[model samples]
Each structure stands twice: as structure tokens, then as C-alpha cells.
Target: MTPTATGIAPTTNSTPTTHAGPAIEITGRLGERYDEILTPDAVAFLTELHHRFSGRRHDRLADRMRRRFEIGNGRDPRFRDDTAAVRANPDWKVAGAGPGLEDRRVEITGPTDPKMTINALNSGARVWLADQEDATSPTWKNVVEGQLSLFDAIRGQLSFTSPEGKEYRVTAERTPTIVMRPRGWHLVEKHIRFIDRTGRGMAASGSLVDFGLYFFHNAQQLIANGSGPYFYIAKLESSEEAKLWDDIFTFSEEYLGIAHGTIRATVLIETLPAAFEMEEILYELRDHCAGLNAGRWDYIFSIIKNYRGRGARFVLPDRSDVTMTVPFMRAYTELLVKTCHKRGAFAIGGMSAFIPNRRDPEVTQRAFEKVAADKKREAGDGFDGTWVAHPDLIPVAQAEFDAVLGENPNQVSRQRDDVEVTPAQLLDVHIGLPITAAGVHGNVSVAIRYIEAWLRGLGAVALDNLMEDAATAEISRSQVWQWIHQDRETEDGTPITVAYIEELIAQVLGEVDRRDGDRFDDAAEVFREVALREEFPTFLTIVAYSRFLVDTE
Candidate 1:
């Protein structure tokens, strides 16, 4: 029998409290306690709590996380925003997705390391993503320290004290935009303050949100600073979840002198349910949603978590020898882009893996070719970008994205505008524009993006989304790379060419136009769905699928 805290009865069972006590440990599902912080019942109860806990309990604990760690207890009576134009930016709502939504870019993610991020940046895709939550050490201390280092790197730190001095590529920083994946709740406030100070509060121009409430508090803090901050919200499962955030934003700005629409937001589409309600969520939050970014790993984990009752049917069996390109991974990427573009926000793709694959030089060349082909496919579908892990593979990553952007189109490149866009103006695009029928992938941007990815090799790495690879994978992918010249035919037999790529996109767009009308109908929406169809890579997916999207059967 176990020892009793009160010495009452060895056999007497004690109920667990929301807040752990010495008598009742706070353990995770495995029943292993950290300093006797948990018990079996505690673990079981916590797991159930994630799905069924009442609002009263949620409010109490969430408030604790905020008050104790400065994570965010909900309303910030002082927070205010002046930049409402970001909400009404015309660029946020691109009419006629062309194919899928991520039609213009791909992501090449690396670890949180500076070297890894720079490498991926050299590749060519539009965004450089960094992470601190899943791929990096999850402890509070390491995460806070690691994220601060990235912030320093981004601000172009100067060492007036030390002659040794350190500097990054170009005068300031390369790549059009920067994205970071900071630690979630556990170290949220610490991480935000670090980035803010490191960047000299330049984070004022940046948007920072973590994976959960932990992530939101940082953004709240930033907004509370008499400024505006943007965010990419992750792990969300429903439109109701979207509404909570909307309400959170609403209340956060109430009383504060800030503009209601200043806080731009994008959703990290990770879970299956989120993936399923993609379009509806997009439509519902069309006023607030910035865009949808793909989340492959978490998406897979979600299917396993939520669909295990279906047995083998839930996830695919592990297949060796070939890359794990599951139908669902591909499907998820496609749907993400479509959802984002349909509503006018950028449809961004996610990272492939944490480790760089392709150890043999020949294998590397072949893999690059395959990845390039896939990028073209995604561009044709409509994804604006995708993610990469290794800097060496940046070129490979960008080569794939080049096809979708097409000569820059001379459009405004900033994330926000100065004046408000009326709902009527937005509705005109939503209801009046014919659904785009363009689909194809090929161009200088594609090759340039790849070149940039390799150059970054992690040195010019991203700060958002914990997509493994980064340092370790770079060497492996490089070891296997053959460095063949561009425009070579791939192992998949797809010839690389801008003209041919454009034709491909045109075909896909034509099909999309046929499915989408001036007005939306449920069945038409289903047909336009990028996920429901498997064999055919929808317009957006063809561009976003990298080697690491993960195969879901």
C-alpha cells in the first residue's frame, strides 16, 4: 500500500484537485510524475479535461497561466491599436486563386538554430519559418533562451564591445518576409519580451502568437504596448474556436484606444477537424482571417488522436523504401491553400521535415528534381508558398515555388494598408469575381527560391513552425545532392519549363472556374475542395507538397 499524506488509511483513495498538492501528484498520461507532481487519476483527468472540461475550470486555469506567467488571462483593459488598415488590406483578399490557394510560395524550415534558418532563407520561397515548441527542447528555460537568440540574429546585432563581431548575409536581412515559431504557454511571456527587446521592440512591426493561449498572451502583451502585432494561430479545431479568438480580440480591444481590425490573424490548419471545416471557417472569419498556413505533422498526430477508434483506417501503415507521401498529407496541404485563397488571405504551406534526407549525391539530385516538380504542382493548385528544413535544400524548396508568382504582377507587397477597405469592396471580390481557372507552375522565382534556400542552409532560417530538419538534415541532404543544372527533367518524368508550367496552371484554373460560380453552393464547394479528391493533386497542393508532408493513407 502507498503511504498516506494524512496517515488516514493506506487504502483510502484521494481525489485530485485542479491545482496539484503534495498528497495528489500531477502526472501526464504515462503516470510518471515530475517530482511527484501527478498521479494516475490526475493524468487521466487532465487528458479528459482537454476535450470535456467545463468553461468555469478552463477560465480558472487559463487565467492562472496568464496571471502567473503573464500568458494572458483574457481581456487587457489597456490594449489599443491604431493600425486598422491591415484588416482591410486588398492584398489579403486575392480574387481568383488561379488553382489552389498557396499559389505563390513554399516553406523551407530548419531548426531554431541561426545557421539552419539562414540556409533555408537562401533557398527561395517567400517565407523563412522558425520554431520553439515541438522541434526544439520543450523545457521552459531552453525555449526562452533559444528564441531570444533568434531575435538577436534578426535585429542585426552589433558587437561594439567585441572586435570579433558577428553579422548575417546582405546589409540588413534577405528574404521578403520573416516568420517565427516561438515556445507556447510554458515560456510565452519570457519569449515575447526577449524577441521584443532583442529586436529593439521592432517586434512592433512583427506579429507574435504562440501555439495556444500561451501563444496569444505574447501577442496580447505586444498589442498592449500601444502598438499592433500580427499572429499565426495554431492547433485550432473548429470555427467556434475561431470565434473565441475573434471574441478575444474584440474584448482585448474594447475600452483600449486601439483599432478593432489592427490585429491581423492567420490560422495554422493542423488538426483534421480544422482541415474539414477549412472553407466554412475561412468564410466565417473572412473579416478577420489573414490566411491559412499548412501544418502537416500536427495534422497527422491529430488524425491519430481523434480517429483512432477507426482502427487501421485512421492512419496509414508505415511504408518503407519510398518517401512517406500519404494521401492525406497531400490532401491537407491542398485544402489549406484553397481555404486561404478562397477567402482572400495568403494560403501558406508548411515545412517538410526536421531532418534533411537524401544522403547520396545522386539521391539528392533526384530528390531535388522530384521536389521541384512537386512545387510546380502546388503552384498550379494555388499555394503561394511551402516550408523547408535544411538550408542546403533551400534552392530545391524555392525552385518549386517559382512558377506561381509570375513576374511579380507589380502588386503592393506590404502585409497591411493605410486605409480601410469597405465590406462592399471585399464582397465584390468574394461574390463578383469569377473563380480563377489558371493552373501551372514554372518561373525564375522558383529557381531563385531554391537557390536562396540552399544559401540560407539554416543561417537565414525561419522563426515559426517547428518543422525539424535544420542543422542535421542539411548535411545529409547536401551529402546526397548531385547539384545538377536547373531545367532538367525529373525522375517523375515532368519536364521543367515556365511556359509548360503556365499551361498546367491554366488547365487547373479552368477546372476551378467550372466548379466555382459567382455564388457558392454546397456541392460546388465540395467539388472545389482540395482534400476530397486523392489521385489528382488539386491546384494548391501541387505546389505545397514537399518530401516531408507525411502520408496519411
Candidate 2:
């Protein structure tokens, strides 16, 4: 077992049978029924949760590179005056709605592959985010076939066929409520390796190997099918990465005896420093918190990688002109529905990645009237649920969260309390409107059509009708590397250069044909080496997964 330029090594008397120690080995290639999901108790519960929280996720990723070198030497991220007594405690609330997540209006995400996990658990959409991060392309055979298609979709033993023989399954009597998401805490799982407490050997936490192998094989079969072990948390920034996911969900509910608020989680206020620590990250996961989402293109690629070169008042515009009804994405979704209904939780909303082109009935009626005026403005701004990457726009975002939650399964009691926002209006990014040339050739044709479908293993594509992923190729190559280092210009003025994005990536890789012209000319030289490089990598799938997707020897 050798393979290394990223992973694969295990079998020298395999291991990881934890009481929180040794047995951290399983390196990679375990295909064709990956030992029913790399078991040995899911590699000893992801090597005892990466040897207990990989040192608080490497000291919160070295306090996120010392707060991105103090927001690149000017420091602006506000709201955390040392968490202000956990956001002034305002009668704490979080852990309440659990069991199949008490109706999540209309979720529906993608990529767990077995035909988008049996068409997102038969897509009626009451929640089915099931992605293994940015609609997956993790490629250790799509992360061990997305944990064997969510372990045959929580025991319904998933189905699929399609090499034009069309099959697919999950004829829902009850589905959707799956949640999952994993991979972000800056991804790793390089085929898995462990030895941490200083013996060194690393690469593991793709958020604790996708939440410790899906909470060690579906936490008691998704808590005896009433659905527990849910989660979505990705790219967190602070509330100390939500208290390192509330101490890895209280050490995975006391190492799977399961029951301490039976693992909930939602967060993903998508980093502009997690939208001013949304009430101290919902009071540090108020006991496995389940709320807060609006992750619009990774919150505009975390506000162009935390305000790159902080000038032109944090310039941003044209990643399809930033609209979640603008004012800095409506002050980060009205302060995430007033910090998740003032802590009772459940906010959600953001993602109508729109993909309906069944022979274009006027491009699916102008994308269903722009996803019905964006889910009737997130159900008239209180949200309780919203996301639809396509299941025919899930009854148009569940008929606008069922006309503002009718038989009321949620709205978490709509306490937006005339929301107040601020942190200079979530860094207002000088009220948007600028960059164009059709948004710089729609960010060089959606970053060379999503890095040539994420180096061919594919990570959710759909293209022009929308549904692109990997957070839309990381907000289209971080807005073409912050519009070629802010020489931005466009809208007929010109500037955005690097030789006009390498002459529009050689006229869009010479109109792609010869079997995808050398993977769109290696995805336009990995999108001009991470968009005309000057060092703003942050994450373009961590250097395109160690240079054009790993798997060496």
C-alpha cells in the first residue's frame, strides 16, 4: 500500500480500532464496495475524530492565518469584541428542532452521485442537501463513492443504472431530510492518515472525514429513521469555528452512544468572517445548533477572500452582479434572519442555483420568474427554509416556503424583530455595480466550465442554465482574481487584463471539441494559475486538488 502524491497507504495490518488512539491507517484505493465504507468502525471513528479535534482544527487554522494577517493589514472584520459575553446571552436557545428536522421547507442540494443520490432522495424537497461538500469532486473515487451512496441511502439500499438504461430509485414515501454536507475546515482526507499528537503524519479532517464517516455509519441508522445526525456546516470562520463544531458535536455524542441533542448543525453564514459572528455563531452552536445559511457563492467567495487589497472599498461586482437583493447581500440575509430567530434557530435560505431547461419553455419561464422572485423574497424575509438546485425548482421553492409556512412546520416563530445588521452593513462592499464585459466572459466561461468538470471526475456542472458548484467554481475564480487585482474596469472601459484573461482563455479553449480539447486546455491553465496569480489562493479546491487531482505512487 504506497500511493502518495496525496493519498493511499493502509493495509500493512490495517488499523484504527479506537479508544482514541493508534489504528489511523487506511490510506486510499478500496473501491468496488469500499469495504462497505472503509469500516473498522469507520476507520476508528475517523481516527478518534482526528485525534480529538485535530488540535482544535489546528488552532482554528492558526486563527485563520492570524485573521488573514489582520484582514491583510488593515483589519475590518467586526462584531467580535471577544464574543461580547456570547452575544449578550439573550436567553439562549438553539437545540430544539430535530427529528427529520421538523420540516425544512424546501432544501434540495446535490452530488452524492449514485444518480445524485437517487435524485436527492426522491426530491420532494423538505431537505436533502446530501452533498459531500460543494456538490463533490473529492475523487478518491468521489470520496469512496460518496460513502457508498450515503450508505445505500440510510438503509433503503439506494439504486441507479443509467448507462442509458435508465433506472434510479427512492420512490419517496418519506425522503429529503438527509442534510449532510461535510468537507470544509479547509479540506484534507488525502486518502486518510493519522499519527497526530506530534508523531506528525497528517492529512485527515475533510471535516473529520466527512463528519466522522457520516457519524460512524449513519448514527444509529439516522436515529432509527426518524432522522437525527443531520449537518451542513461548511467553511466556518469564527465563533471559534462554532466552538470547533461544538466540540465536534460533543465528541460525536459521546462517541456514538448518541443522544446529546442528537447532532443537529446548520451554520454556513458563508464567511465574511461568518457575517459578523452571527450572534457569536449561534452562541457557539447552542447545543448542536441547527440554523443560519444564506451561503451565496461562499458568501461571494468570502468577500473576495476577506477583502483582498482592501481598496475601492472592498471591490466586488459581477459574479453575476452579487444579488441576494444586494445591500451586501441584504445585510447577510437580514443578519441571518435576526440571528436565527433570535436563537431559537432555523433560518436557512440562499441557493436557487436554477437548472431547468427541459427544452426551454422560454428558458423555463425565465427560470420560473427568477425562482418566483427569489422564493418570494425568502418567504417575505424571515426564511425558515430555501434552497433548490433543481428538482424542477422544487415546486418553486416549495411554493414560496408554502406561502410563508402554512401548516407551519417552521419560521422558527419569525422573530426578525425589525432586524438591525451593521458591521458597516456587512462591509457594504461599496454598494456593488461595476465589473462587466458580460461579467468578464461570465468569469471565463464559468472557470473553464468548472475546471473541466472538476478535472473530469465532475463536481456538479449544468453550466449556462446555472447549477454549477464547488461554490460556483469558488465564485468564479474569486471573481477572476478580484478582477485582475482591482484594475477591474470592464463595463466597456476595459482593464481586467492578464492579457485580457489570456485572450479569453484562448477564445474559450478554441470552442471546445476534440473530446473536450485537452480538458479545456487543462481548465485554461487552471484558470490562469488561479486567476492570474499574485497570491490569493485561499481555495480553488486547494490548488486544484494538488495539481489536477491527485492519485500518485
Candidate 3:
């Protein structure tokens, strides 16, 4: 079996003796002990999931496209008439929090690298969102090693040593609960291919690969430890998608012999359409639903992307100017709290993407103050918990939540019935703030830098004292595209055109320091394609990943 460019050999074998599943081929290089994570049984489980649910995933994605086309053609999203019953019924409630997820007051999110796993577990946060989505680059090595890291961490044997001889370990007496967040349904794991009956092979679904692999490997162990297979579902756009996840969870639990309803999920209301379907989404996954999170960064990006073609009224201001206090954002959060609490579910707040600069005390102090205020608002607004990017911000966020939820695990009982948000309020994008030249420059700089880092196999990067992930990068590039299409101008009366953006990209390249193997050139090209093209790309990461990350011959 000679390996191909993707590092695994192409085979036409319909049945491998190792398992009784579909023909599955590993197209990625297996690292040391990677075989343990990608065992034959686990691969069979992934194959089974792909066989059962991949078609529905494709259909749902097509539905997303059709909906996006409707929005582009002036059909604004409103509360669905079909799901009115689901939303109107007030007696129903979700399953609520599971064993280890009762108090997610402070969840520290990061990539699933070995060191990050140790640190996040040791962080004072109540939940460690083991991220395999936005914060991960999905390289073959990263995907495999992430599973290995979590494998070790779950068994209490994870550790790492730095090149400078420093040691890291999960040493906290009471570590945070682990909540794995897999990639959304839109992505595909190119390194693994599933061969259909006709000898045709296609990339495996990224969501199923991540979720199936982790759950297959760790579900029983987690149950033995008194925790369950908890998850954070990201980037869902409709109740149907939520139902798909719920179905997957049910099937997985049954297959693994775990008790029913042992799997709990908190859905991230990141998409514009999803905000309108929050109640329906929770209702679809009611038996397995834990809560809804304010995925604020992606939520902003979604608004800009969905309404990009609706003219100046839909155009957003500078990214910095769009804070939580903005009308639309406020409406979204308040509505989320109201809906979740009304349904007996926790209402988690958004991420504070502030990473402390250790050398600069003033900058660190300012970051802490800002995060404190942000968490304070969420806590006061009846949120059960919030998110912080770095572990250092955990204490700051926990302090705020602690001040409000002193002895209570959560404030799910505090219903926000006074909140009544209309579709107009949710669609109102009037920021009234002027877009500044600095905003344009910052967008260009951050997009290029973040893309460069992602191309170098890093998904989460700290730039300008904040953690920039795929979501933030989406906002940066989408804003650039939106501004140019809407003929937006900076405050000083300079028009935002492709030529001007090209000049800015050049200037930013010169200012940004390049490492030995930096991908700044490629990153700039990608930014230009996504940000300056007449037809907006749905996702910048998708374009970059298919081009740069996949190991093609």
C-alpha cells in the first residue's frame, strides 16, 4: 500500500477485517501512538456516523445557502411561522445542566494542545471548553495529537515540558469540567475519506470525525469519573441542525451503551438566523440541551455576512465601536437570556477576548477592568456564566459572577419575562458611529496576520493584547468586504475601495514582522480574494483551508 500525497494509500477494499463498517481510509500520517486514538473500532464508529448522517448534513447546508440567497434578495429572516408552536409553548423546558456542567461561571476556551489542556484544566474556570473548532487549525498532526492530549488528560496523565526546560501539568486540586466543542457541520476532514458503495470516496464530515472520535475514545471513561460526554455545539443556523445533533447524540449514547440523556449540549447562537430560532433550537434538543451561549464574535460576523448586500443600512460600524451595549447586540443577549431562562436553561454570556500582557502592567490592568465590567453586566442581566479567552481572566470573570451567584450554581431561576424583542430590534444595525481609518487598517492588519498564523498551523493568536481566532478573523475580513461593497468611507472622507485596501495591505505587510517561514505573502493573497472580491466568500477559513491546509499532491 503505497501512500499518496495525503500520506495514506488509496484502496478499493470494501470491507476491512478489523471492523464491520464502511470502507474507510486514513489519508493522513499517523503520529506516534496515534493508532491508539484511531483504533479500528473508533474508525468504524466514525464510518457508521458518516453513513447515517452525512446526507442530512449536506441537505441542511443547502438549506443554509437557500436561506442566505433569500436574505440577499431582500427576504429578511423573521421568527419562523412553522415553529411558532415550539416558541409559544411556555410549559416545556430543556433537560438543563448535567453533572459536571451545572456551574459554568467561567469557561476558558483554547486549542486542545497538550500544554493548553493542562493549563485550562488547572485554570480556576468551572468549565474548560476543549476547542477543536475555531481555535484549532485541523492539521493532521493537530487533530491526532489533540485527541491524544485529551486522552491523557482524561486519565490524569497529561503533561508537557517546554524547550526551555520548564514543566507543565494539571496540578489544581479541583479542575474545571471538560466540554468538547467539535467543528461545525460545514467543514470536512480531508485527511480521512469515506468510500461509498460505488467506489467513490469523499472527505469525512469534520463534525462527526471530531465528535465521534472523542466520544468513542472517552465517553465511558468520563462516565466512570462521574462526568458525561458534554459538548458545546457551534455555528448552528436552524432547529433542524439542532435536531441532527440531538439525533447523533442519541445514537451515540445507544451505541456506546451509555444511559440515555447522558449527553448534554449547549448551542452557540452565533448565526443571524439562529438568533431568530433560539427557542426552536432549544426545543428540538430539549432532552439533551443544556443552554444557549452568546457566541458574540461570530454573531457580529454573521450579521455582517447575512446583510452584506442590503445596502448602507445593514452596514456595520468599526468593529471596535460595536460593543455589547449596541441595540442589536443588547436585544440578542436579552432575548437569549429571556428565552433560555423561560425554558429552564442556563444563559451563558460571550467571550472576553482580552489576553493580559504580562510585561505591561497598565495594559493588563485596563484589560482586567474591561473584562470585569463586561462580566458584571452579564451577571447582572441574569446570565448563569460567561467565557474568557485566557486563564488569567478567569478570576476576573468568576469574581463578577461570584458577586451575583454567591451560593447558587446558576441563575436559571431568574426569568427575564420583561424582555420582549421584536424582529425589527434584532435586525436594527444602526450603530451611528463613524468608521475610522484606523479601523480599516486594523482590519487589514489583523486579517493578514491571523491568516498567516493559521496558515502556519496556529488558529488562535494574540495580537494587540487580544486573542484573535477564526471568528474574529471572519469579522475583520467580512467588515472589509462589506465596507467596500457598501461604498463606505472612513471618518476623514477617504473612500474604501479595493485599490485603497490593496495599498493598506501593502503598508501592513511592511509594518508586520516576518518570521523565517511566515506565510504573509499567501495570507495577503487570501485576504485580497476574500475581502476585495465582488462576490463575497462565505467563509475565509474554508477558502484558506482547502487551499493551504490540505496536503494535496
- How far in Å is the alpha carbon of 234 misplaced in model 1? 1.9
lDDT of 2 by residue, 463-504 (tens): 888888887787878778777887878878989878988888
Clashes of each: 117, 2, 0
- What's the true lDDT of residue 345 in model 1? 68
- Give the number of the best model, judged by TM-score: 3
Estimate the TM-score of every prediction: 0.47, 0.33, 0.96
Ranking by TM-score: 3, 1, 2
- Please, what is the whole-model Cα lDDT of each candidate in the order they appear? 0.38, 0.79, 0.90
State model 1's lDDT.
0.38
Better of 2 and 3 by lDDT: 3
Off by over 4 Å in 2: 1-75, 80-83, 87-110, 115-129, 136-152, 162-221, 225-229, 233-263, 275-279, 290-300, 305-309, 312-446, 451-458, 461-468, 488-499, 514-553
Report the Cα RMSD per candidate. 19.3, 22.9, 3.2
